[model samples]
Target: MSTFTLDELVRVLRESAGEEEGVDLEGDILDVPFDDLGYDSLALLNTVIGIQQAVGVTLPDDIVSQELTPRLLLDLVNGHIARPAAGKA
Candidate 1:
């Protein structure tokens, strides 16, 4: 299983929704809220879609609304990736 790293998240975020001016995504932003990073719910939703496409994971529909920070989101995505799909175990 491929681990979803912060770098990948940053890339998807930038691709789905352009970063805010003066906001450095390369910085330590794992705990930073998406709003503080100039990302609204819509941007996050788009990013979630992008991640699902890239990582081939079926995240929950409310994932974006639930995971507000990169760390939390990463944990959730990685958890999904680590677990086997239904009936596969």
Candidate 2:
């Protein structure tokens, strides 16, 4: 099974869109809202795309809006990664 960690998310976020000024992604940001982290909708959307490319997962279109925090996003992605495809089992 594939696993997506907070560190990976930070890396993908930086790769997709450079970190905002004065924001420390290395700190405890799991619960912090994306807005508080200086990330807008567009930035998050790009990060989602990056995650998709990096993890080979097809996330839902509404994921960006649905998962506001990093922890939430991690949960959603990991859940998707752990689930088996339809008709396989």
Candidate 3:
């Protein structure tokens, strides 16, 4: 899998946060909290879906309950991307 850079991940988060147009995607997403991202649980679920769509990997459910931060999310994505394909054993 291709590595997803921090900037690209931040841009995706910003877009998911509904700030996609001209806003600076580099800004901190944790400026307030996940709620302010204008996303309800369903939207967040869809955001995870977006992540899957963009990166071709599924995020663990616990990641959200743990209060995903920008940095942590990037780390999680990086980890997923770095892992070998399933059933390669």
Clashes of each: 0, 0, 0
Candidate 1 versus the native: TM-score?
Answer: 0.89
Tens digits of per-residue lDDT, candidate 3, 1-89, equal: 67877677655655564553444545666443455544556555666667777888867655564365556666777777787353132
Instruction: Report the lDDT of model 1 for residue 66.
Output: 37
Scored by lDDT, model 3 comes in at 0.61
Residue pairs clashing in model 3 are none
- The alpha-carbon lDDT assigned to residue 10 of candidate 2 equals 97
The best candidate by TM-score is: 1
Candidate 1 regions exceeding 4 Å error are 84-89
TM-score per model over all chains: 0.89, 0.89, 0.61
What value does the lDDT take at residue 2 in candidate 1?
A: 79
lDDT of each: 0.87, 0.86, 0.61
Ranked candidates, highest lDDT first: 1, 2, 3
- Return whichever of 1 and 3 wins on lDDT: 1
- For 10-78, candidate 1 gives per-residue lDDT tens digits of 999999998999999999999998989999898988998999898998887587763489999998889
